[model samples]
Target: MNIDDILAAAESEAPDTRTVKVCVNPAVARKRAALLEALKQAKELDAKASTTEERLGAAPAPTTEHADRAQAELEAFDDEVLKSLITLKFTRLDGERWSNLTAANPMRVDVALDRNYGYNFDAVSKTAAMLTGVRLSDDGEELLTPEQWDRLFKRLSGHDFRLIIDAVWTLNEYAPSQHIEALVKGFGAA
Candidate 1:
């Protein structure tokens, strides 16, 4: 193996990336969850109605009507949810840069002269810095500043904020085996 070829391959490697959909409003999220459950029930009902029709040679009117109504409601609510969802893309930073950023935002431990008192991860600050350049739009535009990220974290429900944080962390720390598995699946390899 030529040294120059290895150097080129390393330099040309693309960072791993992940995307997450976030619904910031707690009410909307709850409603969406309910609608999804209802939709699942409707599908089961529809399947049963079809089977009944096949077996009896007569369609069940009430079951079909209920399933149709449930499907319509789900479709309308899905449109609303789509309008409110914010899609965030997270890209991994290269090793040296990632190391530097984490080093600069160390989790501090509080200690007395005699013994250890406590430790603070300062998660908000650390996460904000780690995600600064890593977070982007679907179109590859930078999404938010640190201040904006802080404000978003404050405004979002814990569940919603955690979704974004998880995406960012996963992209940065995902295992090579996972990547290979994904590629294998893409190629339909057993």
Candidate 2:
């Protein structure tokens, strides 16, 4: 029985209370049935022993192993669903609207991007990239800074150019070249 029903039954049986037959609530009865089934399964797994230590010592059967595997797979499936909901990608980013993302909140922005791509830039690198007009290597293994990094950083901080640049960088990482072109063209129209 659940806590509430157990408490009610004890209260009814107390000398302080007057009661005839104390019936089990339907909801509590249903839950007790489930609990009993689980208890029976546990007992069966323990070579039909009545104690916990015996159950713990028993060798897990093939069916138990399969049940464990299925439970793990089910957990993975649920995690994937949750990740998909939390990391949905946007086809278009409004550069002006999200300019703040390039400044103080770049870390959060990169973290959000990581949820989609399974990777992200550290705060130091992301901030440096925003300040200096640096491009990542085509293979994503290197960073290039042909121009003065500090000057570029100052210029970017003054205006909102990094918003567009960051959007392009994100698109390049996730989309095909042709799609990146289409995105740029679409952004130009706005």
Candidate 3:
């Protein structure tokens, strides 16, 4: 290919992006967790009931009713939780910017190499750089400023906050081969 063709291809490449949904309401989060636990326990009870029926040839009616009730509650609450979630979109930084950012914020860790000296990532700065001024809309019409992002981050639960940061880091740092591996695994390919 000509140099012009190579330059055009490079310039046309779109930035990688990822979106994460975070539950902002503590009450909704608690309710969702409780519903999920109830559903899990109900499923377990149903399985036990099935095993008992195979042995004794009689399954209790109450077990089926309980499981059905728990499932219905969870399904109904799932819709509500979906409506309450705050969606954040992260875009990958350019290679040079990403390298500079990582260099500026390094964390020390134990390595397998000599002297156990390993430098890793600094979570705080890296997350800040990745999540700052994130888009809030698909059309890129709305965005959260750095200050707004910080406030939102602080408001999130520990689990929710970690999920957002992890998604951002993954979008920016995960290799293309890793993405293909994930896609293959998701499709249950050997």
Off by over 4 Å in 2: 1-110, 121-147, 158-161, 177-190
Model 1 lDDT per residue over 53-141, tens place: 77897754445665678778877887777666766666676666555555665445443411221222235223633464344455666
List the global CA lDDT of all models.
0.63, 0.40, 0.68
Model 1 RMSD, rounded to 1 decimal: 7.8
Cα displacement (Å) at residue 123, model 2 = 6.8
User: After aligning candidate 3 to the native by TM-score, how far in Å is the CA of 178 from where it should be?
Assistant: 7.1
Compared with the true structure, what per-residue lDDT tens digits does model 3 show for residues 1-190? 9999998998898777777778777788889899989988988888787778777867544357668999899888887887668777677776676666666655454534212312244353345444543645547636676677667767788888777767766765665548778999999994
Error of 1 at 141 (Å): 3.5
Best by TM-score: 1
Better of 1 and 3 by lDDT: 3
Q: What's the CA error at residue 60 for candidate 3, in Å? A: 7.5
Residue pairs of candidate 3 with colliding backbone atoms? none
Error of 1 at 12 (Å): 1.7
Task: For residues 67-174, write the lDDT of model 2, one tens digit per residue.
Answer: 444445455455434332211112322344224443444344336754544434334324433333223333542333535434433433312333433544554333
Q: All predictions: root-mean-square deviation over Cα?
A: 7.8, 27.4, 7.2
Query: How does candidate 1 fare on TM-score?
Result: 0.62
Score every model by TM-score: 0.62, 0.21, 0.61
